[model samples]
Target: MIVFLCVRFLVFSFVWPFIGGWREMYAANDAIPLFINMDYMKDPRYFAISFRRFFKNFLNNEDLRPGIYELRFSKPEKVCVLENSVLSSERTLDVIAYAPRDLATENGVSFEKEIYVRGSAAIGQNNDLRALVCDGDVSLAKNTVLRRWLDAEGNISAGEGCNLGVSLTSGKECLVAAGCVFRRLYGAPVKAGTSRKKSFALAARDDEERVFPPPPLGAKERQLEEIWPYSDTRFSVITPNRLWVGANSRILGHIKTYGNLNVDDNVLITGNVFAEGDIVIGQFCKILGDIFAQGSVSIGEGSQVGRPGKIKSVVGNQTVFLSSGAAVYGYVTTEGDGRVL
Candidate 1:
C-alpha cells in the first residue's frame, strides 16, 4: 500500500509540470493567424492598406512592429481616423484603436497585446474581439461590441452590451454597465485548457481533495477556478476587490470576489456568487445559482435566490437576512445567524 502511494505521488509530480508547460505553450500559439486568404483581401473599400505603406516608410528598427498596425484615412472625407498611432512602447504588441467616430477593422485581432482606445473603438458588427491585452485601464463608451479574452493591468469600465468574449483579468476592479455581457473574469493567472470534460473532472476532484489534504506550503496547485477550459463560455469571474455588477445586467458565468459585492435590481446571474465581504442582492432580481458570502448577505424583497428546488443557498461567517416577499427555493445555510423578516 505504501509503495503504491509513493509511486503515484512521484508520477503526479513529474507529469504535472510537463502538462502545465504544454498548456501554456498551446495558449501562446493558439492565436497565430495561419493564412490570409487573398479573396478576403481583395475588397479595398472594406479592407484598406494605407497603414502597411505608412509603417514601411515611417517605422524603423527602433520602433516596435506590431502584428496588426493601422493608420488610416477615411475616403472622400480624408479624415485621419488613426493618426500618429505609433507603437509608443516596444514592449507592447497588441491591438489598439484611436478614432473620433466609428472605426471598422477586419477582425482577426489576437496575440494578447495591449489595446488603447482614446475614442470609441469597434470592429465590423460581425467581428469578434479575440485575445487582446490591456496593460492599463480600458474605458469605452456605450454599446461597444466585443468577443475575446482580455488581460488588463488596471481597471475596466465598459458601457452597455459590451461583450467580454471569453476571459478577463483585472489588476484592480471591473465595473460594467447595464445589459453588458461577460464570460470569465479573473484577478489571478488562470491556467488555459483544451477540453471541458477533462477540466471539469479535474475540478470535481480538486473540490474533493481541498477538504482532505492541505496543499504543501509553497507548492503551487491549480485553483478550482482555473480548471475550466478556455473554450468554455461558461467560465468563472474572479477579482480581489469590490465587484460591482450593474443593474439589469445578465451574466452567464460564475462570480468570485475578494471584497464587497453590490448587484443591482433586475439582474440575472446564472451562476454561483462567491464573495469575501458583504453581498447585497437588489429587488426583483433572479439568481439561478448559489450565494456564498464571507460577510453578511441580504436579499431584498421580490428576489429569488435559486431556481425552484435546484440548488441550495449558502452564506458564511455572518448574518443571512432575507427581506419580505423574497423566495429562496432551496435550503439556506448560514455559518453565524440566519433570519427571515
Candidate 2:
C-alpha cells in the first residue's frame, strides 16, 4: 500500500503539469475564431515573398484595367487596379497596385488604410493619397496632395506645386524641385560614426549604467524613461542613403541619415535630425530638434535651430556655421570652431 501510494503521487506530479499545459493550449486554439484562420494576409500568405507571388498569380490576366476586382482578404476587399494596367477606384477601401502597372484616380480618392503599390503610382490633381508604400518609383503630378507616411523603395519625384504631408521615405534618391511643399523627406540610412549602430551600442551601455550607476531618477521617472521610444509603436522610416528637401518644405519627425541632408529655404523641422555628412539648411529654415552631424553644419540666414532664443543644436567633430540672422536656441558644442553670428 505504501509503495502504491508513492507511485500514484509521482504519477500525479508528473502528469498534471503536462495535462494542464495541453489543456491551456487547446483552449487557446479553440477560442480563436475561424475567421482568423481564413485571413490570408494573417496566415502564411502574409510573408514578404508571398506578396510577390500573390501579385504575379493574380495579375496573370491580360488587358487588366479598372474594375471591382474582389480580392480574398478578410472580407473580399476590392482590388481596384488589375495587373500591369491603368486603373481607377471609386471604392473607399485602401487600394493596392501591382508592379509593371500604372494607377490613377478618376476623382480625388481618400484611403483610410495605407496604399500599397508595386510599380509606378500617380495621383491626379487635387487628389489626396494617404499613406503610400511602394517598391518602385512614385510621382506626384501637379497640384496633387499627398497625406501621411509616403514610403518608396525607389526614387520619388514630385512635380511643381505638389503638397506632401509628413513622413516621406525613399530607399533611393528624392528630388523635389521648386513649388513643392513637403514635410520629412528621407533618402536612406547608411554606415557612419554616430549612426543607428551607435544608437544600439549606446542603448546597451545605458542598460548597464542603469543597473550599476543607476540614473538619479525617481522610480516612476525611471520606469517611464525606460518604456519610452520602445513602447511607442509608431511606424518609422528606414533608408540607406541621401535626403533632399526642396524649398518651402516642412518636416516634423525624427530623422537619422547615413548620408547628407539638404534642406531648402523656408523649411521647418520639429524633431531630432542627425546626419553622417554635411547638413545645409537654407534661409528661413526652422528646426525644433537637436541637430547632430559628423561633418560641417551650415544654417542659412533667418534660420533657427531648436526654439527661438534657446540653442539646442550640437555638432560633433566639425564646424558649425550659423549665418547672420540665424540663431540656435540651444548651446552649440563642436570639436571644431562653433561660430554663430
Candidate 3:
C-alpha cells in the first residue's frame, strides 16, 4: 500500500505537468471572453443620444399635452415635461426637465436635474445647472455654472466666466468667451471668444509667399520635408532639449521635444507635435495635426489647430489654455483644468 501511494503521488506531481493535465481539467470553454467596446466608450455624445432616444420613446407613449406635467414611472422615478417654452426666472426646478420647444431661463435660476431642450436654449446669467442637452443652438450668459455636460447640435455660445463642467460638445461651432473653464471640448471648430477668419486667411497667404529657411549646415534635408521647395518629405525632428521654432517658419514633419516647445507667431506645422514638457504655440499659428504634451499646453490667439474637414486632437496631461480667436477642429482635452483666455 505504501509503495502504491508513493508511486501515485510521484506520478501526479511530476507527470501531471508534462501530460497537459491542467489544460484538460480546465476546459477552454470555461474561460469567459473579455471585450471592451471602445466605440461606445469613446463616443462623447453617447449619453445625450441615449437620453434623447429614451425621452422620445416615452413621449410617444404618454398622453400628456403642452403643459408642465410631473411624470411618475416606477418607484422613485419621475420627470418633468414641458411641452412649450420655459421662460421663467423665479423658481428652481429639482426634477429632470424636458422641453420639446425652446427653453429660456432668467437670472439666478437653479436646476438640480438634467435638462433636455429640443429647440434653442437661452440660459440667463448666474444660473446653475446639472446637465443640458439641446438639439438647436444654445446660449449661456455670464457666470453660469454647469455641473455636468453640455451638448448642442447647432452653434453654442457661452458668455464669460462660465464654468462648463465635464464635457462641452457642439456639432457645428462652439464659441467660448474669456474666463471660461472646461475639461473636455469637442466641435467642428471650437473657437475661443470669437471667430477670426481674417487672421487665418492672412496666415495662409503669408505662408504661401514666405521664403523658407535652408536646413542648417551639415543637416541632411530629407525628401520628406513638406515645405514649399521640399513638400514631399516626411520625417520627425527629435530633440533632447527645448526647441523654439521661429516666426512664420513652416515645418512639414513631426516634432518631438524633451523640454518645452515654443513656437513663434504664424508658424505652420503640417505634422503632429509631441512634447515631454510644456508646449506654447504662438498667435495665428496653424497646426494641421494633433498636439500632445505631457505638461501644460497654451495656444495663443488666432491659432488654428486642424483643417475644416479633418479631425485632430490636442491633449495635455496638465492644464490647457486657449486664447481668444484660437480654434480647434476636433477635440481638446486636459487632465487638469482647461481655460479660455
Candidate 4:
C-alpha cells in the first residue's frame, strides 16, 4: 500500500498540471472565447488562431497576451461575456485564477451546458496592478525609449527600424528589424538616479556613472540616453540570424528565411515565395502567399494554415500541425507530421 501510494503521488505531481489544465479548458461551451476584430483582415483564418489561443490560455494551454487587464475569468461554472458588451473594472485586479485546468481548443465544435456572465461589464484601473505601455509614440522607431520603472514593470523589445509591441529596459539592448511589433503585457518600473534636478546619460559599458555629451537642441535628432544606431542596412539586406514571432504580435508580409522559424500565437502572414529550413508556425497563419519549406514544418494550436496567407500551397517534408486548435488554409502536400502545439 505504501509503495503504491508513493507511485500514485509521483504520477499525480508529474501529470496533474497538464491533465488538470486540459479538463478545465474544455469543460464547457462558454470556457474562454477569444475576442478580436474579425473585420480586420482575412476572415475565418484570423479567428481560427485567436480562438485557439483563447481556449488554450483559458484552459491553461498557453501564455496570456502582453497588455491584458481584467482577462475575464470565472470559476468552475462556465461564464461568458458577449460582444457589443462591456465589463466593469476591478481595483488591484481582485480576479486571479490559481487553480489548475486543462488546455485545449474546440475549433468549430458545438458546445452544450451552462455558461453565465455572472457580473456586469466592469472597467476600471488599479494602482498596484500591472499595466503595459509603449515606450513612446506608437509610430516611433526602435531607437526610441519610453519611460517606465524597473521596480514595477518588465520590458519587451524588437530590432531597430521596426514597429513593436515589445519593451526595452534600461542598460539593456535588443536588435530587431524594421516593421516588427513588440507587444509587452507585463511592465517594469523605471530606475531613478539621485540627480533628480537634471537629466544625465549613462556610459555605454557602465551603468553606475553618467557622462556629459553635447546637448541636442529640439532639432538635433531626439537624443536617447541609452540608444545609438550600430549598423547600416541601407546598402545591404536586413536579415536576422534567427527569426521568432510571439503569439500576440499582429504581423503581415512574407519574411524571407535562411534559418529557423518559430512562430507562436496568431501570426498573420501574407506568405513568402521561398523559405528554407525548419518551420514552426503556431495557431493561425493566414497564408495569402505560398510557403515552401526545405526542412520540417510544425503547426500548433487551432491555427488555420495554407492558401490565404501563402497565396499558393505549402510543399515540404516532415511537417505537422497537431493540435485541437490546428487549422490550415493552404494546400499541404508535404510529408511531415508532428504535434501541432
Output the number of the TM-score-best candidate.
3
Q: What overall lDDT goes with each candidate model?
A: 0.48, 0.54, 0.81, 0.33
Worst 10 residues of 3 by lDDT: 222-231
Tens digit of lDDT per residue, candidate 3, span 300-341?
988988777768999999999999999998999999989999
Which is superior by lDDT, 3 or 4? 3
Kindly indicate the candidate among 1 and 2 with the higher lDDT: 2
Colliding residue pairs in candidate 3: 223-233, 224-233, 224-234, 225-233
lDDT of 2 by residue, 262-318 (tens): 777766555677888877877766666678889877777656564423335456557
TM-score of each: 0.32, 0.36, 0.79, 0.28
TM-score (C-alpha) between model 2 and the true structure: 0.36
Q: Judging by TM-score, tell me the better candidate of 2 and 3.
A: 3
Please provide, for model 4 over 1-341, each residue's C-alpha lDDT reduced to its tens digit, 9 standing for 90 to 100: 99999989988888876886777778855676688867687321232234334544664644333232344434343322233222232211223221121111111111122111212111122112121122221112233322221111112232233322122221111222332222221111111111112111111112213222322222221111111122111111113444565554433334545666676555554335244677776554433345567776654544444322122344556553333333333234345332212
Ranking by TM-score: 3, 2, 1, 4
Q: How high a TM-score does candidate 3 get?
A: 0.79
